[model samples]
Target: ENKAMESRLRQAGFPYVRTLEDFDFAFQAAISKRHIQQLTTMQWIDDAFNVFFLGPPGTGKTHLSVAIGGAAVDKGYKVRFISMDQLVSAFRTESTDPKAHRALRAIRKADLVIIDELGFLPITRTEANQFFQLVNDLYQRTSIIITSNKSFEEW
Candidate 1:
Protein backbone atom coordinates (compact mmCIF):
# COMPACT_ATOMS: atom_id res chain seq x y z
CA GLU A 1 0.00 0.00 0.00
CA ASN A 2 2.80 2.40 0.75
CA LYS A 3 4.39 1.83 -2.64
CA ALA A 4 1.07 2.24 -4.38
CA MET A 5 0.38 5.47 -2.47
CA GLU A 6 3.65 6.93 -3.60
CA SER A 7 2.70 6.26 -7.21
CA ARG A 8 -0.73 7.76 -6.67
CA LEU A 9 0.64 11.01 -5.32
CA ARG A 10 3.04 11.29 -8.23
CA GLN A 11 0.12 11.12 -10.61
CA ALA A 12 -2.21 13.32 -8.54
CA GLY A 13 -0.57 16.51 -10.06
CA PHE A 14 -1.61 18.74 -7.21
CA PRO A 15 -0.56 22.35 -7.82
CA TYR A 16 0.59 22.61 -4.22
CA VAL A 17 -0.14 20.77 -1.02
CA ARG A 18 -3.04 21.80 1.20
CA THR A 19 -5.13 20.04 3.80
CA LEU A 20 -8.36 20.56 5.71
CA GLU A 21 -6.33 22.06 8.54
CA ASP A 22 -4.79 24.55 6.10
CA PHE A 23 -8.13 26.03 5.10
CA ASP A 24 -9.70 28.99 6.90
CA PHE A 25 -13.41 28.30 6.94
CA ALA A 26 -14.19 31.28 9.10
CA PHE A 27 -13.14 33.67 6.36
CA GLN A 28 -15.22 32.06 3.60
CA ALA A 29 -18.73 32.36 4.93
CA ALA A 30 -20.25 31.94 1.46
CA ILE A 31 -19.28 28.31 1.47
CA SER A 32 -21.30 25.86 3.54
CA LYS A 33 -19.10 24.78 6.41
CA ARG A 34 -21.23 21.74 7.12
CA HIS A 35 -21.19 20.65 3.49
CA ILE A 36 -17.45 21.05 3.10
CA GLN A 37 -16.93 19.21 6.38
CA GLN A 38 -19.03 16.31 5.14
CA LEU A 39 -17.09 16.20 1.87
CA THR A 40 -13.82 15.57 3.66
CA THR A 41 -15.12 12.10 4.53
CA MET A 42 -14.66 11.11 0.85
CA GLN A 43 -17.89 9.11 0.88
CA TRP A 44 -19.06 10.67 -2.36
CA ILE A 45 -15.98 9.25 -4.04
CA ASP A 46 -17.03 5.79 -2.94
CA ASP A 47 -20.40 6.34 -4.59
CA ALA A 48 -18.76 7.57 -7.84
CA PHE A 49 -20.64 10.86 -7.70
CA ASN A 50 -19.44 14.29 -8.80
CA VAL A 51 -18.55 17.40 -6.80
CA PHE A 52 -18.50 20.94 -8.17
CA PHE A 53 -17.06 24.18 -6.78
CA LEU A 54 -18.40 27.34 -8.40
CA GLY A 55 -17.56 30.91 -7.53
CA PRO A 56 -15.47 33.88 -8.54
CA PRO A 57 -11.75 34.17 -7.89
CA GLY A 58 -10.33 33.93 -4.35
CA THR A 59 -13.30 31.97 -3.12
CA GLY A 60 -11.25 28.94 -2.06
CA LYS A 61 -12.47 26.67 -4.85
CA THR A 62 -9.03 25.24 -5.62
CA HIS A 63 -8.11 25.08 -1.95
CA LEU A 64 -11.23 23.11 -1.03
CA SER A 65 -10.79 20.70 -3.95
CA VAL A 66 -7.13 20.06 -3.18
CA ALA A 67 -7.95 19.58 0.50
CA ILE A 68 -10.76 17.11 -0.17
CA GLY A 69 -8.79 15.24 -2.80
CA GLY A 70 -5.79 15.16 -0.50
CA ALA A 71 -8.01 13.64 2.17
CA ALA A 72 -9.01 10.92 -0.28
CA VAL A 73 -5.38 10.29 -1.12
CA ASP A 74 -4.58 9.84 2.59
CA LYS A 75 -7.28 7.16 2.62
CA GLY A 76 -5.48 5.43 -0.33
CA TYR A 77 -7.71 6.36 -3.22
CA LYS A 78 -6.10 6.88 -6.65
CA VAL A 79 -6.57 10.59 -7.15
CA ARG A 80 -5.59 12.87 -10.06
CA PHE A 81 -5.88 16.64 -10.33
CA ILE A 82 -5.70 18.51 -13.66
CA SER A 83 -6.78 21.85 -14.96
CA MET A 84 -9.49 21.94 -17.63
CA ASP A 85 -7.12 23.74 -19.97
CA GLN A 86 -4.62 20.93 -19.73
CA LEU A 87 -7.28 18.31 -20.25
CA VAL A 88 -8.58 20.12 -23.27
CA SER A 89 -5.10 20.39 -24.66
CA ALA A 90 -4.66 16.66 -24.22
CA PHE A 91 -8.03 15.94 -25.82
CA ARG A 92 -6.93 17.78 -28.96
CA THR A 93 -4.27 15.14 -29.54
CA GLU A 94 -6.07 12.05 -28.26
CA SER A 95 -7.07 10.85 -31.68
CA THR A 96 -3.55 10.49 -33.08
CA ASP A 97 -1.15 10.53 -30.19
CA PRO A 98 -0.14 7.52 -28.15
CA LYS A 99 0.99 9.83 -25.34
CA ALA A 100 -2.50 11.24 -25.19
CA HIS A 101 -3.94 7.76 -24.71
CA ARG A 102 -1.50 7.16 -21.86
CA ALA A 103 -2.56 10.36 -20.15
CA LEU A 104 -6.26 9.59 -20.58
CA ARG A 105 -5.66 6.06 -19.34
CA ALA A 106 -4.13 7.42 -16.16
CA ILE A 107 -7.27 9.42 -15.54
CA ARG A 108 -9.41 6.35 -16.26
CA LYS A 109 -7.55 4.26 -13.71
CA ALA A 110 -7.88 6.86 -10.98
CA ASP A 111 -10.65 6.50 -8.40
CA LEU A 112 -10.98 10.24 -7.96
CA VAL A 113 -10.27 12.92 -10.59
CA ILE A 114 -10.33 16.61 -9.74
CA ILE A 115 -10.69 18.84 -12.85
CA ASP A 116 -9.94 22.43 -11.93
CA GLU A 117 -10.53 25.79 -13.63
CA LEU A 118 -13.24 25.24 -16.20
CA GLY A 119 -14.41 28.37 -18.01
CA PHE A 120 -11.17 30.16 -17.31
CA LEU A 121 -11.02 30.58 -21.08
CA PRO A 122 -13.49 29.98 -23.84
CA ILE A 123 -13.26 26.69 -25.67
CA THR A 124 -14.10 26.09 -29.29
CA ARG A 125 -16.97 23.82 -30.29
CA THR A 126 -14.62 20.94 -31.09
CA GLU A 127 -12.84 21.26 -27.79
CA ALA A 128 -16.15 21.40 -25.99
CA ASN A 129 -17.23 18.14 -27.65
CA GLN A 130 -14.01 16.44 -26.73
CA PHE A 131 -14.36 17.48 -23.11
CA PHE A 132 -17.92 16.21 -23.07
CA GLN A 133 -16.72 12.82 -24.21
CA LEU A 134 -14.18 12.67 -21.43
CA VAL A 135 -16.79 13.63 -18.88
CA ASN A 136 -19.24 11.07 -20.22
CA ASP A 137 -16.67 8.30 -20.04
CA LEU A 138 -15.85 9.07 -16.42
CA TYR A 139 -19.39 9.74 -15.32
CA GLN A 140 -20.94 7.18 -12.96
CA ARG A 141 -17.68 5.18 -13.05
CA THR A 142 -15.47 7.37 -10.88
CA SER A 143 -15.67 10.48 -8.75
CA ILE A 144 -15.07 13.84 -10.52
CA ILE A 145 -14.65 17.15 -8.73
CA ILE A 146 -15.03 20.14 -11.03
CA THR A 147 -14.01 23.67 -10.04
CA SER A 148 -15.43 26.36 -12.26
CA ASN A 149 -15.83 30.10 -12.25
CA LYS A 150 -19.04 29.74 -14.23
CA SER A 151 -22.29 28.04 -13.30
CA PHE A 152 -23.90 24.97 -14.88
CA GLU A 153 -25.91 27.28 -17.05
CA GLU A 154 -22.71 28.62 -18.57
CA TRP A 155 -21.35 25.14 -19.11
Candidate 2:
Protein backbone atom coordinates (compact mmCIF):
# COMPACT_ATOMS: atom_id res chain seq x y z
CA GLU A 1 0.00 0.00 0.00
CA ASN A 2 2.83 2.37 0.85
CA LYS A 3 4.53 1.62 -2.46
CA ALA A 4 1.31 2.25 -4.34
CA MET A 5 0.87 5.56 -2.55
CA GLU A 6 4.42 6.62 -3.40
CA SER A 7 3.82 5.77 -7.04
CA ARG A 8 0.56 7.71 -7.06
CA LEU A 9 2.24 10.72 -5.48
CA ARG A 10 4.99 10.63 -8.10
CA GLN A 11 2.48 10.29 -10.94
CA ALA A 12 0.47 13.20 -9.51
CA GLY A 13 3.35 15.53 -10.48
CA PHE A 14 3.12 17.86 -7.52
CA PRO A 15 5.84 20.48 -7.50
CA TYR A 16 6.21 19.97 -3.74
CA VAL A 17 4.47 17.99 -1.08
CA ARG A 18 2.04 19.91 1.11
CA THR A 19 -0.61 18.71 3.51
CA LEU A 20 -3.68 20.32 5.05
CA GLU A 21 -1.91 20.11 8.42
CA ASP A 22 0.99 22.18 7.12
CA PHE A 23 -1.28 25.07 6.11
CA ASP A 24 -1.25 28.01 8.53
CA PHE A 25 -4.81 29.23 8.71
CA ALA A 26 -3.76 32.02 11.04
CA PHE A 27 -1.69 33.63 8.30
CA GLN A 28 -4.56 33.67 5.81
CA ALA A 29 -7.34 34.86 8.03
CA ALA A 30 -9.69 35.45 5.12
CA ILE A 31 -9.90 31.75 4.40
CA SER A 32 -12.50 29.69 6.24
CA LYS A 33 -10.94 26.89 8.23
CA ARG A 34 -14.19 25.02 8.35
CA HIS A 35 -14.54 25.12 4.59
CA ILE A 36 -11.05 23.81 4.13
CA GLN A 37 -11.75 21.01 6.54
CA GLN A 38 -14.85 20.12 4.57
CA LEU A 39 -12.80 20.07 1.40
CA THR A 40 -10.31 17.71 2.97
CA THR A 41 -13.11 15.19 3.14
CA MET A 42 -12.88 15.00 -0.68
CA GLN A 43 -16.62 15.22 -1.08
CA TRP A 44 -16.36 17.98 -3.69
CA ILE A 45 -14.08 15.88 -5.83
CA ASP A 46 -16.42 12.96 -5.54
CA ASP A 47 -19.21 15.19 -6.77
CA ALA A 48 -17.07 16.30 -9.70
CA PHE A 49 -17.35 19.91 -8.66
CA ASN A 50 -14.77 22.42 -9.83
CA VAL A 51 -12.95 24.59 -7.29
CA PHE A 52 -11.27 27.90 -7.96
CA PHE A 53 -8.81 29.69 -5.71
CA LEU A 54 -8.69 33.24 -6.92
CA GLY A 55 -6.59 35.93 -5.27
CA PRO A 56 -3.61 38.13 -5.71
CA PRO A 57 -0.06 36.86 -5.67
CA GLY A 58 1.28 35.37 -2.41
CA THR A 59 -2.19 34.68 -1.04
CA GLY A 60 -1.58 30.87 -0.80
CA LYS A 61 -3.90 29.84 -3.63
CA THR A 62 -1.42 27.36 -5.04
CA HIS A 63 -0.63 26.18 -1.56
CA LEU A 64 -4.27 25.41 -0.86
CA SER A 65 -4.83 23.75 -4.22
CA VAL A 66 -1.75 21.60 -3.86
CA ALA A 67 -2.67 20.68 -0.33
CA ILE A 68 -6.14 19.61 -1.42
CA GLY A 69 -4.72 17.66 -4.34
CA GLY A 70 -2.29 15.90 -2.03
CA ALA A 71 -5.15 14.97 0.24
CA ALA A 72 -7.03 13.55 -2.73
CA VAL A 73 -4.03 11.49 -3.77
CA ASP A 74 -3.71 10.10 -0.25
CA LYS A 75 -7.36 9.08 -0.38
CA GLY A 76 -6.65 6.76 -3.34
CA TYR A 77 -7.86 9.20 -5.99
CA LYS A 78 -5.83 9.86 -9.11
CA VAL A 79 -4.59 13.47 -9.24
CA ARG A 80 -2.59 15.52 -11.70
CA PHE A 81 -0.91 18.88 -11.16
CA ILE A 82 0.12 21.20 -13.96
CA SER A 83 0.77 24.88 -14.46
CA MET A 84 -1.39 26.90 -16.82
CA ASP A 85 1.58 27.38 -19.10
CA GLN A 86 2.27 23.68 -19.27
CA LEU A 87 -1.38 22.91 -19.98
CA VAL A 88 -1.42 25.48 -22.77
CA SER A 89 1.69 24.02 -24.28
CA ALA A 90 0.23 20.56 -24.19
CA PHE A 91 -2.92 21.75 -25.90
CA ARG A 92 -0.91 23.56 -28.54
CA THR A 93 1.15 20.51 -29.38
CA GLU A 94 -1.26 17.69 -28.63
CA SER A 95 -2.00 17.22 -32.28
CA THR A 96 1.59 16.88 -33.51
CA ASP A 97 3.20 15.56 -30.38
CA PRO A 98 2.43 12.09 -29.13
CA LYS A 99 3.87 12.95 -25.72
CA ALA A 100 1.51 15.89 -25.36
CA HIS A 101 -1.39 13.71 -26.41
CA ARG A 102 -0.49 11.17 -23.74
CA ALA A 103 -0.16 13.91 -21.16
CA LEU A 104 -3.61 15.22 -21.98
CA ARG A 105 -4.97 11.68 -21.86
CA ALA A 106 -3.49 11.20 -18.41
CA ILE A 107 -4.92 14.52 -17.24
CA ARG A 108 -8.34 13.58 -18.53
CA LYS A 109 -8.19 10.29 -16.65
CA ALA A 110 -7.37 11.89 -13.30
CA ASP A 111 -10.02 12.30 -10.62
CA LEU A 112 -8.64 15.74 -9.75
CA VAL A 113 -6.67 18.14 -11.90
CA ILE A 114 -4.90 21.13 -10.38
CA ILE A 115 -4.12 23.99 -12.75
CA ASP A 116 -1.79 26.43 -11.01
CA GLU A 117 -0.49 29.91 -11.79
CA LEU A 118 -3.18 31.01 -14.19
CA GLY A 119 -3.00 34.58 -15.56
CA PHE A 120 0.78 34.59 -15.03
CA LEU A 121 1.15 34.68 -18.80
CA PRO A 122 -0.94 35.90 -21.69
CA ILE A 123 -2.16 33.46 -24.32
CA THR A 124 -3.37 33.97 -27.84
CA ARG A 125 -6.98 33.67 -28.91
CA THR A 126 -6.40 30.22 -30.32
CA GLU A 127 -4.85 29.08 -27.09
CA ALA A 128 -7.82 30.45 -25.17
CA ASN A 129 -10.16 28.46 -27.39
CA GLN A 130 -8.10 25.36 -26.83
CA PHE A 131 -8.24 25.91 -23.11
CA PHE A 132 -12.00 26.30 -23.27
CA GLN A 133 -12.25 23.11 -25.28
CA LEU A 134 -10.20 21.20 -22.74
CA VAL A 135 -12.31 22.51 -19.92
CA ASN A 136 -15.44 21.58 -21.79
CA ASP A 137 -14.11 18.10 -22.37
CA LEU A 138 -13.31 17.61 -18.73
CA TYR A 139 -16.61 19.04 -17.55
CA GLN A 140 -18.72 16.64 -15.49
CA ARG A 141 -16.15 13.89 -16.09
CA THR A 142 -13.43 15.26 -13.78
CA SER A 143 -13.07 17.73 -10.95
CA ILE A 144 -10.73 20.71 -11.41
CA ILE A 145 -8.91 22.92 -8.94
CA ILE A 146 -7.55 26.11 -10.47
CA THR A 147 -5.31 28.64 -8.73
CA SER A 148 -5.25 32.02 -10.38
CA ASN A 149 -3.80 35.38 -9.46
CA LYS A 150 -6.40 37.12 -11.61
CA SER A 151 -9.88 37.99 -10.59
CA PHE A 152 -12.94 36.58 -12.32
CA GLU A 153 -13.49 39.91 -14.09
CA GLU A 154 -9.95 39.94 -15.39
CA TRP A 155 -10.18 36.37 -16.65
Candidate 3:
Protein backbone atom coordinates (compact mmCIF):
# COMPACT_ATOMS: atom_id res chain seq x y z
CA GLU A 1 0.00 0.00 0.00
CA ASN A 2 2.81 2.39 0.76
CA LYS A 3 4.52 1.54 -2.51
CA ALA A 4 1.25 2.07 -4.35
CA MET A 5 0.97 5.57 -2.94
CA GLU A 6 4.57 6.34 -3.87
CA SER A 7 4.05 5.02 -7.36
CA ARG A 8 1.00 7.22 -7.78
CA LEU A 9 2.93 10.24 -6.61
CA ARG A 10 5.74 9.48 -9.05
CA GLN A 11 3.21 9.15 -11.86
CA ALA A 12 2.00 12.64 -11.06
CA GLY A 13 5.13 13.97 -12.78
CA PHE A 14 6.31 17.53 -11.97
CA PRO A 15 8.61 17.39 -8.93
CA TYR A 16 9.08 13.69 -9.49
CA VAL A 17 10.25 14.38 -13.03
CA ARG A 18 13.33 16.43 -12.65
CA THR A 19 13.50 17.63 -16.27
CA LEU A 20 11.06 18.26 -19.11
CA GLU A 21 12.85 15.59 -21.09
CA ASP A 22 9.60 14.08 -22.28
CA PHE A 23 7.63 17.31 -22.61
CA ASP A 24 7.55 19.13 -25.92
CA PHE A 25 9.13 22.54 -25.79
CA ALA A 26 6.51 23.77 -28.26
CA PHE A 27 3.78 22.77 -25.83
CA GLN A 28 5.75 24.29 -23.00
CA ALA A 29 5.83 27.55 -24.93
CA ALA A 30 2.04 27.45 -25.21
CA ILE A 31 1.91 27.45 -21.39
CA SER A 32 2.72 30.63 -19.50
CA LYS A 33 5.08 31.06 -16.57
CA ARG A 34 2.29 32.37 -14.34
CA HIS A 35 0.35 29.18 -14.85
CA ILE A 36 3.41 27.07 -14.14
CA GLN A 37 4.06 29.06 -11.01
CA GLN A 38 0.50 28.58 -9.91
CA LEU A 39 0.81 24.83 -10.46
CA THR A 40 3.98 24.77 -8.43
CA THR A 41 2.22 26.53 -5.61
CA MET A 42 -0.73 24.16 -5.88
CA GLN A 43 1.68 21.24 -5.46
CA TRP A 44 2.34 22.44 -1.96
CA ILE A 45 -1.22 22.06 -0.76
CA ASP A 46 -2.88 19.79 -3.37
CA ASP A 47 -4.63 22.80 -4.86
CA ALA A 48 -4.98 23.32 -8.62
CA PHE A 49 -4.06 25.98 -11.15
CA ASN A 50 -5.90 27.52 -14.10
CA VAL A 51 -4.34 27.40 -17.59
CA PHE A 52 -5.43 28.51 -21.04
CA PHE A 53 -4.21 27.18 -24.38
CA LEU A 54 -5.08 29.44 -27.33
CA GLY A 55 -3.77 28.98 -30.83
CA PRO A 56 -4.69 27.95 -34.35
CA PRO A 57 -6.11 24.55 -35.26
CA GLY A 58 -3.86 21.46 -35.12
CA THR A 59 -1.53 23.22 -32.74
CA GLY A 60 -1.61 20.33 -30.27
CA LYS A 61 -3.63 22.28 -27.73
CA THR A 62 -5.92 19.40 -26.88
CA HIS A 63 -3.04 16.96 -26.55
CA LEU A 64 -1.17 19.13 -24.10
CA SER A 65 -4.28 19.98 -22.13
CA VAL A 66 -5.16 16.31 -21.81
CA ALA A 67 -1.63 15.47 -20.76
CA ILE A 68 -1.75 18.04 -18.01
CA GLY A 69 -5.12 16.87 -16.80
CA GLY A 70 -3.95 13.27 -16.90
CA ALA A 71 -0.97 14.18 -14.81
CA ALA A 72 -3.24 15.90 -12.31
CA VAL A 73 -5.48 12.85 -12.12
CA ASP A 74 -2.49 10.60 -11.56
CA LYS A 75 -1.65 12.85 -8.64
CA GLY A 76 -5.09 12.04 -7.19
CA TYR A 77 -7.05 15.06 -8.31
CA LYS A 78 -10.71 14.83 -9.24
CA VAL A 79 -10.71 16.01 -12.82
CA ARG A 80 -13.69 16.89 -14.99
CA PHE A 81 -13.47 17.07 -18.75
CA ILE A 82 -15.97 18.84 -21.01
CA SER A 83 -16.11 20.89 -24.14
CA MET A 84 -17.28 24.48 -24.12
CA ASP A 85 -20.21 23.46 -26.29
CA GLN A 86 -21.19 20.83 -23.77
CA LEU A 87 -20.99 23.30 -20.92
CA VAL A 88 -23.14 25.76 -22.84
CA SER A 89 -25.55 23.06 -23.86
CA ALA A 90 -25.86 21.69 -20.35
CA PHE A 91 -26.66 25.11 -18.97
CA ARG A 92 -28.95 25.95 -21.88
CA THR A 93 -31.02 22.81 -21.32
CA GLU A 94 -31.58 23.58 -17.68
CA SER A 95 -32.42 27.21 -18.24
CA THR A 96 -34.29 27.21 -14.96
CA ASP A 97 -32.77 29.57 -12.40
CA PRO A 98 -32.13 26.82 -9.87
CA LYS A 99 -30.62 24.34 -12.33
CA ALA A 100 -28.27 26.94 -13.73
CA HIS A 101 -26.97 27.59 -10.26
CA ARG A 102 -26.62 23.87 -9.71
CA ALA A 103 -24.52 23.53 -12.88
CA LEU A 104 -22.34 26.37 -11.69
CA ARG A 105 -21.91 24.67 -8.35
CA ALA A 106 -20.97 21.44 -10.05
CA ILE A 107 -18.21 23.21 -11.93
CA ARG A 108 -16.98 24.79 -8.73
CA LYS A 109 -16.65 21.39 -7.08
CA ALA A 110 -14.08 20.04 -9.51
CA ASP A 111 -10.39 20.04 -8.61
CA LEU A 112 -9.64 20.46 -12.28
CA VAL A 113 -12.10 21.40 -15.05
CA ILE A 114 -10.98 21.24 -18.66
CA ILE A 115 -12.92 23.02 -21.41
CA ASP A 116 -12.00 22.30 -25.00
CA GLU A 117 -13.00 23.77 -28.36
CA LEU A 118 -14.04 27.14 -27.12
CA GLY A 119 -15.53 29.62 -29.61
CA PHE A 120 -16.65 26.79 -31.88
CA LEU A 121 -20.03 28.54 -32.11
CA PRO A 122 -21.60 31.81 -31.31
CA ILE A 123 -22.67 32.19 -27.70
CA THR A 124 -25.50 34.41 -26.50
CA ARG A 125 -24.83 37.35 -24.21
CA THR A 126 -26.42 35.60 -21.27
CA GLU A 127 -24.36 32.49 -21.92
CA ALA A 128 -21.27 34.62 -21.98
CA ASN A 129 -22.16 36.10 -18.61
CA GLN A 130 -22.84 32.72 -17.11
CA PHE A 131 -19.60 31.38 -18.50
CA PHE A 132 -17.77 34.35 -17.05
CA GLN A 133 -19.41 33.67 -13.72
CA LEU A 134 -18.22 30.10 -13.87
CA VAL A 135 -14.71 31.26 -14.61
CA ASN A 136 -14.80 33.76 -11.78
CA ASP A 137 -16.01 31.12 -9.38
CA LEU A 138 -13.16 28.78 -10.25
CA TYR A 139 -10.61 31.53 -10.57
CA GLN A 140 -7.83 30.94 -8.03
CA ARG A 141 -9.97 28.33 -6.29
CA THR A 142 -9.62 25.36 -8.64
CA SER A 143 -7.63 24.63 -11.77
CA ILE A 144 -9.06 25.14 -15.25
CA ILE A 145 -7.61 24.01 -18.56
CA ILE A 146 -9.04 25.79 -21.61
CA THR A 147 -8.13 25.08 -25.21
CA SER A 148 -9.31 27.24 -28.09
CA ASN A 149 -8.65 27.40 -31.79
CA LYS A 150 -8.93 31.15 -31.81
CA SER A 151 -6.10 33.39 -30.71
CA PHE A 152 -6.36 35.46 -27.57
CA GLU A 153 -6.96 38.67 -29.51
CA GLU A 154 -9.74 37.07 -31.52
CA TRP A 155 -11.37 35.86 -28.30
- Find the candidate with the highest TM-score and give its number: 2
Residue 114's lDDT within candidate 2 is: 94
lDDT tens per residue, model 2, 1-155: 98998998999999998877888999999999899889989988889999999988988888899899888888999999999999999998999999899989999899999999888899999989988888898999899999998888888
> lDDT at 141 for candidate 1?
84
Residues 1-155, candidate 1: write the lDDT tens digits: 88787777777989998887888888888888899889978889889999999999898999999998888888999898989988888788877998877888889888999999999989999899888888888888899999999998988
1-155, model 3: which lDDT tens digit per residue?
55664554443322223222245565557655465445533472255556677877876667666666656655666566678887898778765667545655666787877788888778999989978988888877788888898877776
- Per-candidate local distance difference test: 0.88, 0.91, 0.66
- The clash tally of candidate 1 reads 0
lDDT of 2: 0.91
| Per-residue error (Å), model 1, residue 43 | 1.5
Task: Please report the TM-score between candidate 1 and the true structure.
Answer: 0.93
Better of 1 and 2 by lDDT: 2
Model 2 TM-score, 2 decimals: 0.96
